[model samples]
Target chain A: MSNKEFEQQLQRSVAQLTKEIQPQRDLWPGIEHALNHEQDSQPKSNSWAFQSMAAAFLMIGLFGWLGFNQMQGGDRTEQLVTVLSEPYQQQKQRLLASYANQPALTDNWQQQVQELDDAAAAIKLALKEEPDNPALLKMLKQVYQQQIDLIERVHAPAWQTI
Target chain B: MQTQGQLVDAQEHFAERAVLNLIEAVKAGDKQAYQMLYQQHLGQVYALCYRLTADRALAEDVTQEVFIQLWRKLDNFRGEAKFRTWLHSVTSNVCVSYLRKQRGWWQRMFNLENSEAMHEVAPGSAGEVDLDSLVQRLPERARMVFVLHAIEGYRHEEIAQIMDMAVGSSKAQFHRAKQLLSEWMGYEQ
Candidate 1:
C-alpha cells in the first residue's frame, strides 16, 4: 500500500483495537453480581458507619460529663475556702470587742496591767486570723505575768503564775 | 449565529434518552440497566483506561472500579453535563488515582515486549484490527491524546481538563500524534 493509504489503514487499525478490548462478556455476570451485591451490601455499610458515629458521640458525651463534674468540684473547693475563712474573721472581731470593753485606771499599776491585756488580746486576734500561727501565741505567753501582777495587787494578792 | 454551523451542530447531537433511562434504572437498583450501560459504554471507558494505564488487566480493573463507583454514586448525578462526558471525567480521574496507587504495577506490567500494547479501535464488521505493531511504537502521551481526542471525539479542551494539561498541550500532542503516525507509515507531509 502507498504510505498515505498505509497511514490511513494504521489509523483505522488503532480505532478498531479501541473497540475490541471491552470487558469480557463472561465477567459481565461477575460484574452483575458485584452490582447486585453492591445493592445488597449497602445497608450493612451504612449500619457500620452509623455505629461508628454513635460510638464517637457517646465518647464525646462521656468526656463532657467528666469535665463538667471536674469544674463543679473546683467551685465547691472555692466555696469551702470562703466558708472556712469566715470563722477566723469573726474571732478577730470578738477579740477586738473584748479589748475595747476594758477600762484604764488612774494608777500606773492599773495602766501597766491594761497595756498587758491589750497586747494579749491583739496577739490572740492575730492567732485567730491564722489559726495555725504558733509564733504570736508564744509571744503572748511570755508577758503573761505582768497582767497577773496588776490583777493580784487589786484582788488576789497571793496569785503567783498570773 | 451561523446557519450552516447550526445545521452541523444539530446533526452531531442525539437525544440522550438512553443514557437517562439507564441512569434511572440504575438508580432504581436495576442490575440489567447497569449491565446494559456497561456493555454499551464499556469500549469508550475501557479505551480511556487502557490509554491511561497502558496495561489491559489494570485497565479492566479500573473499568470495574469506574462502574462500581458509578453505581455507588448514581444518585448524585444531576442533569448537568452529558452523562457520557461525566462518565469520562470520572473514569479519567479514577485511572489517575489508580496510577498513583499502583506505580509498581505499571512498571512491571509495561516492562515486557513493547509489541503487546493495547490499541484504541472502533467497532466494525471486521473481527479485529492488526494493532500490535502500530500501538507498540507510538509515544505514550501522543497515543493518549490521539485516542482521546481523535478516535473518541473528545474536544481538545476536554482532553486537557481530563489529563490535567494545558489546552495548548493537548492540541500540540494531537498534532504530534498525527504527524508521528503519518511518518511511521511513510505518509506524505
Candidate 2:
C-alpha cells in the first residue's frame, strides 16, 4: 500500500474499532463483594470511634428511657420487642450473609458485634422484668438500630457517611 | 410530530437525565443505583482498560477497581463534566496506576524493552490479524498513547498528562504505535 493508503487504512481500522466489549463473566458480584470488603478493611482507629459512638448512644438512650418511663405506662413492650426483634434479626442475618466473606475492618469488630448482641439480650431480659415499660421497648429498638448501623458502617461505610 | 433527529435528541437527553439521577441516587448510598451505573458503564470501561492493559485478567481487575473507587469518590463528582467523560478519565488513571503497581521497578525502568515480549505471550497471538490484536502487540507506552489519543479521542497533551510524559513523547509514542501496527497489518510505508 502507498503511504497515503496506509494512513487511510489505519484511520479506518481505528474508526472501526469497537468501543465496547463485554466481559466473559458477570463482574458485578465480585465488585459488590470488594466494595463491602474495602469498607471492612478501613483503619482500626475508626473502630474505636464507632464503639464509643455506639456506647454513647446506648447510654443516652437508657437515661432518656428511664426518665420517660416515670411519665408513661404500657404493657406492650413484649409484643413490640417481638415485632422489632424478629425483622431486625432477619435483616441482620441477610446483612451478615451479604458480607460473609469480607474481613472486618478492626480486629475486634466481631467482638463488638457480639457485645451488641449481648446488650440486646440483656435489654430483652430487662424488658421481661418490666414488660409494661415503654422505656425498655424504646431501648431495645435503639439497640437494634445501633447494631444494624454498626454492621452497615463496617461493611458499606460510604452509604453511612453520605 | 417529531422529526427523526429531534427524536434522537430527545432520547439522548432522557438518557443523560437518567444517568444524572442514578449518580444522585448512588451518592445517597443506594446500592441498586450504583449497580445500575455499573451495568451501564462497565462495557465501555472494560474496553478502555482491556485496550490499555492488553491483558484480559488485568483489565477485569482494573474495571472492578474503577467501579469500587467510583463508589467512594462519586461524591466528588460535581457534574462539571459529562459523567462518561469523568469516568473515562477515572478508568484511564486506574489502569495506569494498576499497571505501575503490577510492574517491578526494573521492568518500569526498562519498560520499552520488556514490553516487547508482552506481544509474544499476549492472548490471540497466533494468526489474529484484527486491529485490536495488533494493538495488543504494541509496547505498553505506545499502546496507551494510541488508545488514549486515537481511539479515546484524547489530545496528545491530555495523554501526556495522564501518562506523565512530555507532549512530544506522547506524539512520538503514537507514531511508534501506528508504525508498528501498520507493519503488523502488512501495510507498507
Tens-digit lDDT track of model 2 for B1-189: 469889999898899889999999999999999999999999999999999988886687668778878899898889898889899988988778767644423253335644655445324222234788778878888989989998999999898888889999999999998777766666655
Tens-place lDDT per residue, model 1, A22-57, is: 655344543554555554445544553465365446
* Candidate 2 interface CA RMSD, Å: 10.9
**Model 1 iRMS:** 35.6
What is the lDDT for B109 in model 1?
33
Instruction: List per-candidate RMSD values in Å.
Output: 36.5, 18.5
Off by over 4 Å in 2: A44-162, B104-106, B109-129
Candidate 1 structure quality by residue, lDDT tens digits, B77-149? 7968888778877877777665544442223334522333323332222224445445445666666677777
**Model 2: chain B TM-score relative to the native chain B:** 0.88
Per-residue lDDT over A1-162 for candidate 2, one digit per residue giving the tens place of the 0 to 100 score: 666767777778778888899877677876787676664556533654576476556656655675566644334555456555776676678768877876543344577678768878987888778777666666676667667666754455432221
- Deviation from native of the Cα of residue B39 in model 1, angstroms: 3.1
List pairs with backbone clashes in candidate 2.
none
